[model samples]
Target chain A: MNPILHELKAKQWIWNASNSQGKGHSKRLTTGYEALDSVLSGGFPSAGMIHINSYLGCGELRLILSILRQMPQHEVAQANNKLRVFIAPPFQLNAEFLLDEKIALEHLLVIKPATQEEALWSAEQCAKSGVCEAVFLWQNQLKHTQIRKLELAALHGQCHCFWFDNNRQCMSNLPLTLSLLLSRENEQMQIKVNKQKVGWAKPAINIKLPFKSRTQLRFKEARKAVNNIVQLRATP
Target chain B: MQFDTCSLWIYLHFTQLHLNVIENTQVHDERELAQPRAIYNMQSNQLVQLNESALQKGIKHGMGLASASLLYPQLNVHEYNEEIEKHALEHMANALYLLSSDIVLMPPNGLVLRAQNMLKLYGGLGPYWQNISRCLSQLGYRYQSAAGFSIQACKVMAKCKQGIISQERDVIEQQLFKCSLAHCDIDLKDFEKLKRIGISTVDELSRVPLSQLANRISRYSVGIIAELRGQAPSKVTFFAPSISYEDYIELLYDISLVDKLVPVLKHALKKLETFLYVRNTQCLHIDVSFYQREHEPLQIGFDSAMAIYRHQDWLEIASLKLEQVRFASPVYALKLVCEKYEVAHASVDDFFTHKSTHIETMSLTSRLASKLGQQKITRLNFIDDFRPEKSTLALADIKSKSLNHAQSVFADRPGFLLETPTLLQQKIQLIKGPERMICGWWDDGVVTRDYYIGQSQQGQQMWVFKTPEKDWYLHGYFI
Candidate 1:
C-alpha cells in the first residue's frame, strides 16, 4: 500500500467524530448527494468554518438546492425557520428551478450592487443580520483575505459559510478551520476534507440527499478530564 | 388650435435658419418618379444617377442603411445623415398629423390620416388643396396628398395625378375605359381584368354590386369594393398602459420637535411601501425633504429609506441611517414624500390587503411608537442587500424586532443565540481561542471581530454578535 494512502486511512479513524457533546452545532450540511456526505464528519454544518472549494456542472449547487428545496415553512404568524441565505451582486438564479422546488418565491430576493466594494459590504452585513443563518458569495473570484474576514464573520454571527465554486483561484494554508475540495465522479458530488481542527481527516464521506435539517451534533475538542475517578475498593 | 409662421420675429433669420433644407432642393428630382435605368441615358441633359443598382435591387428610397442591405444584394449602404431624413419623413408626418390626430406615417414616402373627422374641420376638405400647397411650400419637399374616406380611392387618386388630373369619378369613369393593366401589394389582377373588359374604373368596379364580387374574388374583393366607394373602415383597438400607481399624503402636525415627529414620517413610508407592493415595484431614488421646522429646517434624500429597503433583510441597516436624525429645536411641522415609485408585484394578500402577522407586527410597531417615543421605534425588514448595517432599519415610527416570539429552551432551538461574552471579570481557562472577524470595507468601517462561545466557571451559556472595531456587546442568552 502507498504510505500516504495508509496514513490517510489511519487519519480517517480518528477524524470520524464519535462524541456528541456541547451546545448547538451540526456535524455537516448534507450536500444532498450521498457520496459527498461521507467525507464530512457527519450531517452537520460548522458555524466558524469555511467550505472553500466548489465544482462545475452545477452538481454542487443542485445538491444544496435540493436539500434547501425541502425545508419546511408556514405562514409568518405560525413560526419562522432558524436559517436564511444571502448572495451578493450580479448573483443570479434559475427562476424555473426555484419555482419547481415549491420553495416560497417571496423568500427569494436579489441584491444588485453598483460596485464590488458594495458587494463585500453587503456580504458582511447579511452575515450579521442574525436572521440569515448562512451567507454564500457567488464569487466570480475570491481572495484569501476575503475568506479570512468571512471566516471571522461566521464566527461572530455564529453563521455558516459555503463557498460555491467560481473563477476562484486555488491557494494553500488558509486560516479556515475546515477546507474541503468538492469534485464530481459519475455526476455525483465527492467531498475531500483537506483540514480539520477537532479530529483527523477521513475517507471521502458521501452525505444523503434532500438533506433534512439536522443540527443535533456539536462536539468540543477533547479536554483534559476535570473529575478523576479515584477507584477506592472496599477492603475485603 | 392655429399656428402660423406669419410673424416677423418668429420668422427665423436667414443666418440662424437651417441652410441645408434650402440647398438640397432640386428643380425636378428624378428620384420622385418611377423611372427605369435606361431613362437616364435618354435624358436631355447629363444626369448624376444616385444608387441606380440599389434601387433596382429593391432598396426603397427612404429605407435605412442598416436594414437596406438586407433587402438588396450588392448594396453599398452609407451611414444616415440625420440632416437629410430629418427634412423628409418628419416634415411629411408633421404636415400629415396637422390634418388629424389619428395620422399614421407610412414608410419612405407615404402619409395616412383618419380624414373623416377632418372633412368637417376644414369645411368639407374640398378647398384644402390650397392648404396642402402652402404646407408643401413651407417644407422644401414637393409632395402631393390624395384625400379620400377610403384607402383604395386614396391610392387611385395618387396614381391618376399625371396623365389625367380630374377629381370627378364620372370623368375618370370615361377615361378608365382606355387604361391598361395595373398591379399593387394586392393582386388586383381579377379586378383589372373586369375593368379592362367593360368596368373601366373603381366606380365601374363598385357598380358590379357587393355580393357578385364577394363570390368572384373572395370577401376581400368585397372589402376593396367598399373601400373604393369612400367608406370608413372599423376602428382598431388600442391597449391601456401596463402600470398604475397612486399616492397622496395628509399632514396634521402643528408643532416642532422634529425628532419627536418620526411617526408622521414613518406612516408615509408605510403607505409608500404598501403602494409599491400593490404595484410590484422597487425604489432606488427616495427622498423626504422637510418643508418647515424650528431651527432652519432640513431636507433628507429618501436614500435612508432606499438603504433600508435595499438591506431590508438585515434589521440594523435602516436603524443606522435613521440615527442621523437632526430634530428641530422647536420642530413644529412634518411632511412625508415618496420621490421614486416603480411597479413590482408584491403578493399583497400576504402583506397588504388586510393585516397579516406582518401587518399586525408593523401595526404593533406603529402602536408601540405612538405610545413610546417615535425615535424608539424600528421594523425588522428582510432584504437581500448583502450589507448588514443596511439590511434592517427603524422606520421613523415603524417598530423594531421581528414579530416572532423567542424560541423556548427546554430543548435548544437549533440555531438560536447563546449569551455574548463581556470583558473578563476573572481569568478563565480556554475552551477555544478568539476567532477573529474583520468585515466592511466599502461602507468604510473595517470590523475586526474576535468571537468565543466560551463557558464560564458557573456553566452559563452566552451568544455574542460582536465587532473588533468596537467593544463586545452581549447579543443573546441561553437557558
Candidate 2:
C-alpha cells in the first residue's frame, strides 16, 4: 500500500465499511432496558456528554436512573467513591425514591445555581473535577460553545454527563457523544436517537412501562361488563 | 539570687522603636528613611529617639525640641506614642515566637528570650543568633541584643548598647561588667549618687557590697546592682502568643475599588499562613472586614469545604468573594480574623487508582460556594416524615452526618417534588389509585389528600393529589 493510504488508515480517515462495532461502541454501559440497549448499539457511551431533550417528566430521569444505579458497582468507581452531582434540577429530588433505588445518598450532590450561567459553570466544574462519576445537568437553554466546552470537560474528567433539556425547543447542532429525544406513547415510552458517534441514527423505539393508564384500564373494564351482559342474553 | 546555671537569656533593646515603628507602619517611600526624623516626647518637650539622619545632623536624645529643630531645620518630628511602642514590641515577640518558645516582653521596646533550649535545637549559639538577627532584619527595626546568665544582666548590657550575643557565661559577664551606669535603666538621682561615689561603670558598681549600697543608695538601686551581678532574682512574666489569628492593615491611601485590596490581603494572608503552618493546623472559615471612610465596616465571611491553611487557597477564595462585594465607601483598613482551627491531616489518595486530576472535590465545592452562595450547593438526605415536603432534607455540608435510617411511608414516590401543589390545569389520565394520606393533624395544619400518578395530555408524568372537596392539584413530577 502507498504510504499516504496507510497514513489515512492509521488516522481513521478510511476504514472498513462493514465494521459495525466501532471504537465508541466497545466501551458502553447497559441501559437496563433490553430493547433500548439494542437500539443504542450496546448502551449509552461510557463517558462524554449525552444530551436528552424531552418534556418535563417524560421518563427522562428514569432512563438515567437505570445507568446511575450501576455506576457505583463498577470496579473503578467503587474504589474512589466518586460523587454524582445534579446541577439545577427542575424540583426537589425525592430522597425516598432515590434511597429505594439503592443509590448512595452519601455520594450524591445537588447544586442549585442562581443563574443559568452559574448552572452551566457548576455543571462543567463537576464534570471536569475527576472526583465525580457522573454529572446530571438540567437547564433551559445552552449555547454551542458551552456544549463543546462541557463535552471536553467530561472527556477530560472521564466522567459521564447527562444534560436534560425540557424547553420543548428544536435541538441545536452541538457536538455530543449521544443525543436522545424522549416521549410517551400510551403505555410505552418512546426514545429516538438523533445523533450517535459510531452508528447511524436509528428510528424511534418504544419500551413498555410498568405504569398503566387508568383511562385505558377503565375502558377495558367497561367492555368486559358489556361482553358479560351479551353472553348472559345469548344464554337465555 | 538562685540563678539557673544551665539556662541562658537574651535581651533585645529596640533603640529607636518608636521612630522605626512609625516608619514601618507607614507606606514605604524611597525618600522617607533618607530624611532626618525624630520622635519628640510631648511630656518631656524633648527628643526621645532620632533616626540615622537625625543623629548624623547632631540631634541627640534628651535635647529640647527647640534646640533639636535649630540643629536640623529639616527634622521630621513624630509625637512619641508609648502605647504604639509597646504594641510594636509585642508584635516582634509574636514574630520571634516560632524561633524561641519562651519570651518575656519588656515593654516600651524590649524582649527577653530564653535561648538555652533553642541553642540546642539550632545546634549552636552562632546559628541561633543568626536566625534571630535575620528575623529582626526582616522586621526592619534597629535593636541591640546581649546574652547573660540572668534576665536583668542581659537587659542592662543591651540597654547600654553593648551588643554582646554569646551563650558562654564568661563572655556575657565580661560584657555586662563594662556597661555604663549612665546608660542603664536607673533614675537620674540614683545615677548621680552612683557617679559621685566613683561607680560610673557596672564593674565598679559590682565591687561595692550590697549591704553598703543598701545603706548608701536607694533600695531600688541596690536591687538593680544585685540583679545585674546575678546576685538577686528578677521578677519576670513570660509572654504567651495569642492562638487566634487577627491582622489589621491600614492603608496609607483609601482604596475605592475592591480589586486594589488583593496585595494588602495577600500580605495579611501570608501572616495567617505562617500562623497556621507553624502549628500544623488549618482553618475552615475566615472573616474579612473592610473599614470604610464613612460607612459601617462591611464584613464578609467565607469558608472552605475542608480545613485549609495555604495562603494561595485562601487568596483565591477571597478574591472570588471580593468580586461579589459592592463597596459602599472607600476602604481605609482591612481586618482578617480566623477564630476556629483544626489539626491538619495528610489526605491519602488511592495509589491503585489511575485517574489523576488537579482539582479535588472539596476545592471544587469551595470554589463554587465562594462564587455562588453557600446555600446553593447541598446534599439531599431522607427524613422520616409522612408529608412529601418534609420527607427530604438538604444539608449544606457533605461531610456532616445525615439521618440514614429515615424511611418514607409511601413506597412509590416521584423523583422530584414541587415546593407547593398547584392547581391542575390540564386534563390527566390517572394510572394509579388514590394513596390516601392524613398528616400534620397534630401540628400547624391538617392535610388530607389522595395522591395519584397521572399522565398529562403532553405526555408528562405528574404526581397529583385530590382534596376532600374534590379539588385536584399537581404536586410533583415523576422525572
Candidate 3:
C-alpha cells in the first residue's frame, strides 16, 4: 500500500471516533498561477514551500493572464473535483469568467474565513475531510517563518499549495519545492525554476505572451449581434 | 419430587433467594431504599424497624390501621413509595443489565435470572455467581442470588428449601403430565404443602406417578410441576403490548424543550407505519393529552384518519391538538400511548407504489413546495369533475384526495408546466395579439378569452388575453 494512503486509513481506524465528526486536516485555498506548475516538484503537493512573486507589470494582470492561460482545463478539473474554489475572505471564484473559461462551477465552493487561523483551519478541514484535490492560497504575503508551518500543514494534508507572496524578498526557511525568482528580462518575464529535481532541457525557461492576434472583426460583430438580442429580450 | 397434588391448590416459583441478601434485608436495617445505603447487616444487632417492615415479619398485607397499631407499639413503618425508589431501581436495573439481560423482575420485589447461557460464558455457575456477588457488592445492593437447571430446583436454591419435582422424558408422558393446567405467576404455595405431606424430595414425587398427583394438586400446581420438569413452557413477560397512537404533553411551558422530542416522534411514527404495513393494519383513532402548570390534563381525540397519519401530517395535527391544551406549568415530560389496533391488508402493488411515488413526487414537489409553502405543495390527481380549477386542481396535502382516471384528458402534458399561471406584465408596445379561446363549457368551464402573443422592443414575448368584455389582461410570457 502507498505510505500516505496507509497512514490515513490507519489513522481513521485507531481514532475510534465516529465518522460524524469531520477529520481535522482539510485545506481549501486558491491556486495562483497555471504555467509555473511545471516548475513545482510533484506540482507543489510535497513537503516544502515555494514563494511566488509575480513580476507582471502593467503589470500584475500581464503575468496573471498568462499563467491563467497556461492552466490546462483537464488539470483544473482534476484539482477541483467536486469542490467549489473559494477565493480570499468575502471573494468568490469569479463565476462568470470561470464559466467563460469552461471551468466547472458545480464543485467550486467559495468560503470566507474571518481570520488567518480560520483560513488555515479551513485548509486543514479540507485535507482531513478526504475531499478535493489541490488547494490554492492567494494572500498579500506570509512571513518567512509562517511559511514553515503552512508547508508542514500542506505536507500533512497531502495537498498542493500555491501561495502568492506579493512582497518580494529572500528571507528564511523556504520549504518551497520550486524556488522561483520571477523577473522582467529582455522585455518579457523570465521564470527561473531554482531547486533540485529540475526536469528536462533547462533549469530556467522564458516565454513571450499575448499569443493571440487582433484579427476577426466579423466574429466580434457576430458576438455583438447576439449580445444585442440578449439585451432586447431582457425586459420581457 | 415432593409434590402431593391432593394436598395443594396454588403453586408458584421463586428464584435467586441468596442467603447473604436474606440475612441483610431481614436481620439488619430496612431503610435500604434511601440515603447512603446501609450495606450489610451485623448479626444480633437489634435496630428499630419501620412499621411496615415490622408488620411484614408476621402480619398480612392489608390489616387496618387500628390492628397495625395494636400489633406494634412504636412501629416506625412507612408505606412503599414507588416514585422515590424508582431512581434507585433504575440504577440497579442498569447495573444488572450490564451483567445479564434476562434479569426479569418478580415485581414490587425479587428478580429471576436465567443461568443456562451464562454458565458457558463465565466458565461455570460458581464463577458466574462469584462475579455477580462481586458486582453486587460493588453496587452496594448487597443482594444474593441462586441458580439451578430446573425451575423447582432454582426456586428451592433461592429459598434454601429442599423442594423437588419429577422430570418428564417422553412426549406422551409430558402431555399426560401437563394436560389439566392453568397458567399464573410463580406462586410457591404448592411446594409448602408438599413439604407438609412429609415428602420432600422430587425423586420420591416422580415415583408416585402423575395420576396420583392429578387428584391431589391443583392444575396450577400441576403446571408449576410440569414447568420444573421442563414440560410446561415459560413465556417471557418482557414483551410490552402493542397499542394505537396516544401521547400526552404535561406542563409544557417550554416549547424549545419539547422541540427536542420532534425527531423522536418522527422515528416512532415511522416504526408505527412500518408495523401497520406489516400486519396490514390501519388506525382511525388518535388521542393526545396535555397537562398545564399543575393542572388536570386536557385531552383531544382525533377520530379521523384524514386528520393525521404521516409525520408531516402529525405536525399540524399536534399543533391543533396543543391549541386546546391550556398550560398551567412548564411541562417536564410527556407520554404518548395508543391503545386500539385493527388489521387491514395492503396490496403488494399499492405498497410498492406508495413508496416509489412518494420518492418521485417528493423530488418534484419538495422543490416546488420549498419555493411555495405547505399549503401550496401539490401532486397531480385526476379531477373527479371535469371543470377549470377543478380539473387538474391543486390542494393541500392536509386534505387527502383520490385520483379519478376516467376524465383525465391531458394526453400530452408538458414537463415544465407553471406551478400556477404566471400573469404577464411587460412594456406591451412592439406587438399585440388578443386571439380568442372559449373554454370550460363541456365539462371544462365556460370560458371566453382573446389571447395575445406580443414582442417588445427588448425582444421579449408576452402572452396577453382579452375577455369578451374587452378586458385586457396579461396572462404569461415566453421568455
Candidate 4:
C-alpha cells in the first residue's frame, strides 16, 4: 500500500468495500415496520445520530413513535428509567397519544427552547447524559459541526438521536450513521436512504400506511343528509 | 479541685476579628497581611486592633486615631463593624460544630466549647484541642484560646493572651491568677475601685474575701470573681447550629460582571457543601442574593431536580444561570440561602457495565432547567377529561391524579396538538372519526364538537373538528 493510502486507512477515512461484508453488522433497533426494516438492511442503528428529513405531519413522528414504543426500557438502577427527551418540538406532544402508544409519561421529558442554540445544547446534553434512551430533536437547520457534536455525544452515551430537519432539501455529506428522506405519495410513506455508514444508499421504498382516506363515501353521505333535509323543508 | 468531675471549657477570644474577617475574605496574598493596617473604633475615636506592621510603625491598640495616623501617615484604617464580627464568630462556630458539640457563642468574637465531654471521645484533651486548633487554623482567624474549669476563668485567661491549652485546674488557675483585673470583663468603675485598693492582678482579687470585695465592687463583678474561682455556677447558653444553610461573602471590590462573581460564589458554595456534608443532607433549592450598591439587590434562585450537595455541581449550575442575569449595578456582597434540605441518599451504579459517563436523569434535567428556565423542561401527563384539549395536560402542569387506565373510546387521535385550533384552509379528505364530544357543560371551557381524522393532498394527517355552528378547525397533527 502507498504511504497516503496507509495513512488514510490508519485514520479510518477510506471506506474499504471488503470491510462492509465482513464484521460490520452493528446492533440494530427494530423499526417496528417490517418492510422498512428490510429496506434498511435490518433496522435503525442502535446508537448514534440518524437524520430524518421530512415535512411535519407526514408521519415522521409516527415513524419514530413505532421505534420508541418497542425500545426496551433502560433498567439501570442508578439512572432514571428509560427517559425519552424531545427538544424544540414544534407542537405539544399529546399525552393521550403517548399513553395510547404505551410510552411511560413519567419518563418523557420535553424541552421547548427559545433559540436554535439552546435547542442544540439541550439535545447534546440529553444525548450525552447517559440516562436517556433516545433523544428526538426537531430543528429547522443545523450546522455540520453541531450534528457532529451530537453524533459524538450519542455515541458516548450509547443513545439513539433522531435529528428531524424539515428545511433542508438535500442532505449534506456528513458522516452519520444514517440519513433518511421521507415523503408522502400515493397513500404511502416514501422512505429514501440518502446515506448509511455500512452500505450504499438504497433507492426509495414505499410503505402503505395504516390510515386510509375514504373521502368519496363521506362526501356523498354528507350531501345526502343535506339534500334530505332540503326535500323535507320543500314538502312542508 | 474536683478537676475530674468538673467540665473543662475552652474560650477562644478573637482580638482582631473584624480585621481578620476582612483579610481572610479578601486577601489573596500572604504579603497583604504585612501591610500597615488598623481597625478604628468610631465611637471612641481610637484604634481597636493593629496588625504587626502597624504596631511596628508605632501604632498601638487604644491609641487615638489622630496619633496613629500621625505616626503612620499611609496607614490603612477600617471602621470596626460589630455586625460583621458577630457573623464571623457565628460562622466560625458553625465550622467548629463538627469537632465539638457543646459550644457557647459569645457575640462580638468569642466561642467557649465544653472540652471535657469531647476529651474522652478523642482519647485525651491534647488530641481534642489539636483537632479544634487545626480547624481554627484552616479558617485563618487570629485568636487566643485558654482552657479552664469554668467559662469565666477561660475567658479571662484568653483575654489576657495566656494561650493556655491545658485541662489541669491548677495550671489554668495559675494562668487566670496572673491575668490583670482590667481584662476580667469587669465594669470600668469596678476596675477603678480595684486599682485604688491595689488589687491589680486576679491573684490579689482572689486573696481578698468575697464579702469585702462585694462591698468595694458591683454585685455583677463579685459574681464574675466567684464564677472565675469556680465558687458560683456560670450561666452559659450552648450554641445550636441552624439547620438551614446560609453563607455570605463581602467582596473586596465591586463586581460589575457576572463572570467575576464565580470565584466568590464558588467559595460560598464550598461552605454550603461542607454545611450539607457535615449533616449528611442535601438541598434541592438555593437562593443566591447579590447585594448591589445603588439598586435593589438582585436575587436569582437555583433548584435541582434531585437533592444535591456537591459544590462543583452547584457551581456548574450556578455559572450557567448567572450567564442569563443582567446585573443592574455592581455587587458588593453575595449570600446563599437554602431553607429546605433532604437526607442524602447514596446512589449505586452498576459494577458490571463499563460506561464512560454516568449522569443521573435528575441531574441532567436540573442542568437543562438551570440553563433554560424551569418552565421550559416538563413531563407529559394525561388528564381525565372528555375534551381532546383537556384530556392532555399542558407541559409542567403535573397533577398527582391517577391516570385513567381505561382505553380511549375513540381509537384514532393525533400524536401532536396545536396550542389553538386554526381555520382549516386546505381541503382535507376525511380518514376516520365523527367522534362526537359534547362535554364540559358546567365549566367555562365547553366543547360541543365532531372530531375527524383527515388527510390532505400532501399526505399530511390532521385532526379537524367541526363546531355546532358548522365551522371547521384544525386541532392536531397525526405525526
Worst 10 residues of 2 chain B by lDDT: B350-359
The regions of model 1 sitting more than 4 angstroms off are: A1-35, A46-49, A69-86, A89-91, A140-145, A155-159, A167-169, A175-178, A201-236, B1-298, B303-479
Put the candidates in lDDT order, highest first.
Answer: 4, 2, 1, 3
My TM-score estimates for the predictions, one after another, are: 0.30, 0.78, 0.34, 0.84
User: TM-score winner among the candidates?
Assistant: 4
Listed models, DockQ each: 0.01, 0.34, 0.02, 0.34
Candidate 1, residues B242-269, lDDT tens digits: the string is 2322222223334354444455555445
Instruction: Say which prediction, candidate 3 or candidate 4, comes out ahead on DockQ.
Output: 4
Model 3 lDDT, residue B292, Cα: 38
Model 1 chain B weakest 10-residue run by lDDT: B7-16
Worst 10 residues of 2 chain A by lDDT: A209-218
Ten-residue stretch with the least lDDT total in model 4 chain A = A71-80
Predicted structure 4: lDDT: 0.81
Task: Give per-residue CA lDDT, model 3, range B130-207, as digits (tens).
Answer: 675676675454333434344443443334332222222242233223322112233356656565765455544555
lDDT of 3 by residue, A141-172 (tens): 56544565665665664544455544565543
List candidate 4 stretches off by more than 4 Å: A1-27, A30-41, A69-80, A212-236, B1-7, B28-38, B45-47, B50-77, B117-123, B211-214, B345-359, B395-406, B432-450, B466-471
Better of 1 and 2 by lDDT: 2
Per-residue lDDT tens digits of candidate 1, residues A1-236? 87877896564322324443452344445544445445454544546545646533324554554544432322221243333443442222333233333333333333434455555555655555433445555565566677667766766666656665544355545556566665543323456676654544666654432212122222111222434557889998
Rounded to one decimal, what is candidate 1's iRMSD?
17.6
